[model samples]
Target: MTMNDLQELFVHKLAQQYYVERELVEALDEMARHTTNDRMSQGFADHREETRTQVQRLEEVFAALDRPAEARNSSVLEGLEEDRRELESRIEDDELLNMVYLNAGMMTERVEMTAYEGLTTLGEQLELGNDVQTPLESNYEEEKSAFRELETLATAKDLKSLWEQLTPS
Candidate 1:
């Protein structure tokens, strides 16, 4: 597709995010399986469900736009997933692995947040109706909430112990 107008750019970005969310559902499941901490594993599992809803919301956005629900490849998300798999293969310590997962989760949420922010801004400028705007806003809010949950876990006592283990006196 040619770069012609803001509407085109909006659809392209939306498609990219749709791909990312779809990929995240599987990635979250894998992360949950690999996590040794019960709490962290459950967190990943819960977020996987949320990601599914986010995917559906993105599809709604496509429908509202009267466009087919399609996905563009997101190299950034693919690279992140690759890096996560490589790190998982190399890290053997459960504590350290949990910490890595925490960091990766936070980083992924940040990327999703940015994507939704841009999409919402574009939606407003384009004056898209509530059908499209509502879903994008809902997804964005969920991403923010999930990020905060991970951030809290990062500061919890268990992760503090992990930090202590990594930092020698």
Candidate 2:
């Protein structure tokens, strides 16, 4: 536990966040593959691509700070992933899957938003300026965008129609 500078502190937090974002990229890919609804699956697929670029940006951040991009295991993301696994195992109905996917997507967005907020604050405290802040804001905006999109389709009608389209049973 070394606190050399505020910039270093942000790097530490960013490292953890970067790890989790990487993990989510893989998890979202799998979730997309499992999802029955094309739109829902596409949503996760798009985010996976987004996460890939973000990972590169995170690497740049690490380079700027002269810190190695190390991954601290993120239990927050791990727990959510476990829940996703369990939910998939239990839900056989299409309606259920749609609802569940919406919930899971929302959860991912919230977790990311929280992590980014902390990292952004740390960056500001360290006076990193727009170099770091710009990308973080982009991350924030993307998460919010994804969550709002889910909110629109989380309605009962949308879920029912999607469920019917997805579930053969």
Candidate 3:
């Protein structure tokens, strides 16, 4: 696709988000498997399911636009994933790994939130209507809620203790 107009740009962005959400489904599952903390593991598992739904919603958005659902490669998501792998390789302690996961989860949610925010705004500009806006808004709200939960977990007393213990005095 060429860099032609707003609609094309919107579609490109939407496709990128679609790739992000789809990739997250697998990434979250792996995160859940890696985390020893039960709460964090469960949270990742739950969000994985939500991500699946978000993928479906993105498909709906494509259908509404009369465009075939396609996933544009997201370098942002790729870099984040690469960073995650590098960090995981350097850390062996389970608690510290949990912290990394928590931080990474928060980061991913922030990205998703921003993407959806822009998507919704672009959607409005395109006059795509409720069929498009509703799902995007719902996905955005869910990302916010998920971020709050991860943020809370990141600040919990146990994690704090782990952090304090890990840092050199």
Candidate 4:
């Protein structure tokens, strides 16, 4: 397909998101195993399951668009996952590592939130109507919720103080 219009752009964006969500599934599982805090680990485990559902939702959207469920590699997600892996390996302190995982989760959710918001907006412009918009909106809302939860976790004393220490005066 030609990269000619908003419709194509929307599909391309959907493909990228599909890739991101699938990548997140694996990343979240790894994070769950690495986190020292039980609650934080459970949160990652839970989000991984949600991400699996989201992948199915994306596939549903592809079916609605009468397009094959295809994924385009997302460098952004790959980089985030790689950075998280590297950071985890370098951090010897359990508390610091938990904070790192929390921060990384928040960063990922923010990226997903932005992507879903854009996809929904593009759906509107493309006149794909509610059929297309609904699933994207659902995913957008879930991402928003995940981001809020991650934000709360990041504000936990250990993470907050660690971030403060890292920030330059």
Best by lDDT: 3
Q: Write the per-residue lDDT of candidate 4 for residues 1-169, one digit (tens) a residue.
A: 5698788898999999999999889989988998888878998999999999999999999999999999999888989888988987898988888888888999999999999989988988888877788888888888888888887877877667877887799
Write down the lDDT of every candidate, Cα atoms only.
Answer: 0.94, 0.81, 0.95, 0.89
| Candidate 4, number of clashes | 0
TM-score of each: 0.97, 0.86, 0.97, 0.91
For residues 1-169, write the lDDT of model 3, one tens digit per residue.
Answer: 4698889989999999999999999999999999999999999999999999999999999999999999999999999999999999999988888988998999999999999999999999989999999999999999999999998897888887888998899
Model 3: which ten-residue window has the lowest total lDDT?
1-10
Clashes (backbone N, CA, C under 3 Å), per candidate, total 0, 0, 0, 0
Query: Cα lDDT for residue 94, model 4?
Result: 86
Over 4 Å off in model 3, which ranges?
A: none
Q: After superposition, how far is residue 139 of candidate 3 from its true place, in Å?
A: 0.5
**Residue pairs that clash (backbone atoms under 3 angstroms), model 4:** none
For residue 84, what is the lDDT in candidate 4?
Answer: 85
TM-score of candidate 1 against the unseen true structure: 0.97
The deviation in Å at residue 55 for candidate 4 is 0.5
Candidate 2, residues 132-166, lDDT tens digits: the string is 78888788788788888777767557686765776
Model 4 regions lying over 4 Å from their true place: 157-169
Ranking by TM-score: 3, 1, 4, 2
Clash number for model 3? 0
Clashes counted in candidate 1 amount to 0
